[model samples]
Target chain A: MPRVDVELPSVLTGLLGVPRVVPVEASCLADALRELSELHPTIDVHLFDETGGFREHVLCFHNETNTRWLDGTDVALADGDRITIMQAVSGG
Target chain B: MGTTAVIGTAKGGFILRSDDRRTWSVEGPLFKGWKLTTTSRTPAGTYLAATASDVYGTAVHRSRDLAEWEQVETGPAWPAAAEGGGNGEARKLKQIWTFGHGGNRTYAGVDDAGLFASDDDGVSWTPVDGLNEHSTRSGWFPGAGGLCAHAVLVDPADPKRLWCGISAVGVFRSDDGGASWTPKNEGIPIVIEDKSCKDIGRCVHGMVADPKDANTIYRREHVGVFRTRDGGEHWERIEHGLPSWFGFPIVMDVPTNTLFLAPLESDEYRMPVDGRLSVYRSRDGGDSWEDASAGLPAEHAYVGVLRGAMAADQDGGVYLGTTGGQVYVSSDGADSWQTLPVTLPRVLSVEVYPS
Candidate 1:
C-alpha cells in the first residue's frame, strides 16, 4: 500500500467538519477515495451521486495532474503523492 | 412561537421571528453557500431543510433552533439502478420542492420528479415508488422550472389519501396510501399545445387542499387557476376577477377559509401584472378575487414569486419572498402588506413554522 495526502476544499470542512488535508494509505486514486470515505463516510454524498459517479461539479487532481485526464482512477499511485479536490466553480 | 418564516433562497436560507407579526427579528443566511430549496417543521416538531450545493448536490439538514443545523447523511435520494429519463444529471435527485405529512408519514416532493417518505420523522427516507414508477412516467417531461414534484397534500382526516403536484407531469392522486397512483388532471389545460397527452403534461405550479372539506382543493397551473370540488376528480377554471390566468402560488389562511394568490402578467412575460405586485384574495373560495396589494410598492416592482416562496402562516398572517430578494408580510389576513428591511438572495421557498 502507498501513502498519499488528500486535500479538500473548505466547503467540505464547513459542511462536513472534515479536515482540509487527510493522509491515507492506498495504491490508487480509487482506493485513496475509498479509504478517505472510510475515514469520513459523510463526505461520500458530497463527492458522488447516488449512482456512485463523481458529482458533476467535483474536480479531482493527482499531484497537479487532472485525474479525469488520466485513463482511470485505477492508475498506479506513489507514496507521498498529493490528491487535490475542489468544486468546479468557486461561487457556484 | 408567535410566528416564524423559514425562507429558502438561491444563496442560503433565513429565519424571521415575530411576536405580533409587526416586528420581526432576522436570524440567517443559514447553511451558508448552499441554496435552500425547501423547508418543513414536521409534525413531531423537528425542523428539516433541504440544501443544494454546487459540488454536493442536495441533502437534508435537521435543526432544533432553526439556526444550528445537523446534516443527515441518509436523506432522500434515488437508488443506483433506478433509471429515469433525460441526461445523467437530470436522472439524479437535484432539488427538494416541498415537505408534507399525514399521520406518522412525512412526504418529500423532489426534482427529478419523484416522491419520498420518512417514517421516523425526517431522519431517514424511502422513495415512494408507486407514483415515481407510474405507467405515464415516460411521457412526463420538464417545464421551465425543470421536472419536479413540488407539492404533496395528504387529506387532513384520511392519511391514506394523497395528491401530488408535479410540474409538466400533472397532478396525481394516491388513494391506497401511496401503493398506487392515478393521474387527476381532468379540466386543466395541458402545457404542450399540439399533441394531447391523456394523462401527463399539465404543469401544476402551486396547490393547496381545503382545511376542512377534503373534497375541495385548488391549484395554480401553467395555463390557468383551477378548483376541484370532488377531490381532484374534475377541475374547473377559477380565474375570475384576476388580471391574468398565469400565476405561481396559491396559499390558504385556514381560519378564515380565505385563499390568496398572485397573478403574473402572462406566461410569455412572467412578471407582476402592469408592474404592480398585487396579491389576489378570494374570500368566497375562488368565486371572485380582489386586489389585496395595499401598502406594497406602487410602481416598477416587476418581480415574480416562485411556487414555494409564498406562504400563509394559517393564522392571520401571510408572508412572501420575491425574486427581487425582498420579503413582504401581511399580518391582518391579506388586508395590507409590509416589506422587510433586508435584501438577501433570490428566494425559492418560504415555509412558516407551526403551520
Candidate 2:
C-alpha cells in the first residue's frame, strides 16, 4: 500500500476537519480521492458536479503536474506523493 | 431593537450593525470570494444566505449568531440533463434571488427560473415541481438577466396563494399552494414585440407585495412601473412622474403607501438618467413620483442598481446598493441620503433586520 499526502485549501478546512496536509493509504489517485471523500462526505459535493465529473473550478494536482491534463485519475500513486486540491480564483 | 444591515456583493456578504441610525460598524466579507445574491432572516431568527461559486453551483447557508455558518446540503438544483426531457438545455442553478417565508415553510426564487421550498429551517430544499416542470417552461425565454425567478411572494392571508416573478416569463400565481400555477400578466406591458409570445414576455425587473395587504403588489418592469390592485390579476402603469421608465429595484413602505425606485436611463443605457443619481419616491402608492435626491450626488453619477439591491426597513429606513460599489442609506423615507463609508465589490442585494 502507498501512503499519499493530501492538501486541502483553507475554505474547506472547517467542513472537512482535516489539517492542510493529511496522509491516506491508497494505490492510485482515484482511490485516494475516494478515501478522502469517504472521510469528508460534505466535500464531495464541492469537488464533483452532478455528472460525477470534477467541478470546473476545482483543480487537482498530483505532485507538481495538474491531474486534469494528465491521462486520468487512475494514475498509480507512490509512497510520499502529494496531492493538492484548489479552487480556481476566476469569477466573482 | 438593534438594527443590522446585510449587504450582499459580488465577492461576499457584509453585516453592518447599528444601535443608532447615525453610526454603524461593518463586519464582513463572510464566505469570502463567493458571490452572494441575497440574505434573509426567518421569523424564527435564523439567517439564510444564498451564495454561489461559478464552479461549485448554488448553496444556502444558515446561521443563528451571524458568525458561524453552515452550508445546507440540499440546496436548489435543476433536474439532471439526461432526465430533462431531452431538450438538451444545460440546467444550472446560477443564482438564488429571493427568499419568502410563510409559517414554517421557506421558499426560494432562483435563476434558471424556478422556485424551491424548504421545511427544516433552510437545511434542505426541494424544487417546487409545479413551477419547474410547468408546461410552458420551454417557451420561457431568458431576458437580459437570464431566466431568473427573482421575486417570490407568499400571501400572508392565505399561504396557499403564492406569486413568483420571472424575467421575460411574466408572473405566475398558484392558488393551490405549489401544486399548480397560472400566468398573471394580463395588464403588464410586453417589451418584446413578438406577437406569438405577447402575453408571456413581460420583463419583470422587481416586485414587492404590500406587507399590510397581500392583494396589493407593485412591480418595476422593463418598460415602466406597475401596480396591481387585485393581486396580480390586473396591472396598470404607475410611472407617471418617474425620470425614466426603465429601472431594476422597487422597495415599498407598506404601511405608508410609499414606494422607492431607482430608474435607469433606458434599456440601452442602463445607468442613472442624465448621469444624475436619484431615487424616485412615490408617497401615494405610485400615483405620483418625486426625485428623492436631497443628499445624493447630483452630477456625473452614472450607476446602476440591480433588482435586489434596494431594501426598506420597518422603521422607515431606505437602503440601496449600486453597481458602482456604493451603498446609500436614507433614514427619512428616501427624502435624504447618505453614502456608507465603505466601498466594496459590486453589490447584489440589500437586507435589513431589526433585533
Alpha-carbon lDDT of model 1: 0.86
DockQ of 2: 0.44
For model 1, the superposed segments whose C-alpha errors exceed 4 Å read: A1-3, A90-92, B86-90, B193-197
Give every collision pair in model 1.
none
RMSD of 2: 2.5
If you superpose only chain B onto the true chain B, what TM-score does each candidate give?
A: 0.96, 0.96
Global fold similarity of model 1 (TM-score): 0.95
Report, in order, each candidate's fnat: 0.61, 0.29
Q: Rate residue B308 of model 2 by lDDT.
A: 87
Model 2 Cα lDDT, one tens digit per residue, B1-355: 5789999998888888888766889999887877889999886889999887676667788999888888776787776561331134667677898999887889999887889999888888998999888876766777888788999898987888899998878899999888999889888767654445455777899988886788889988887889998988899988888889898889887667789888899999999988888898988888899988888888898988988899998777889898888989888898789888989899999999877
Kindly give the stretch of ten consecutive residues in candidate 1 chain B with the minimal lDDT sum: B81-90
Q: How well is each residue in B35-87 modelled by candidate 1, as lDDT tens digits?
A: 99999888888899998876688888888878677878678888876656433
Residue-level lDDT tens digits of model 2 in A5-91: 999887666433457887899999999999998776667667787667788889999999999898789999999999999877764
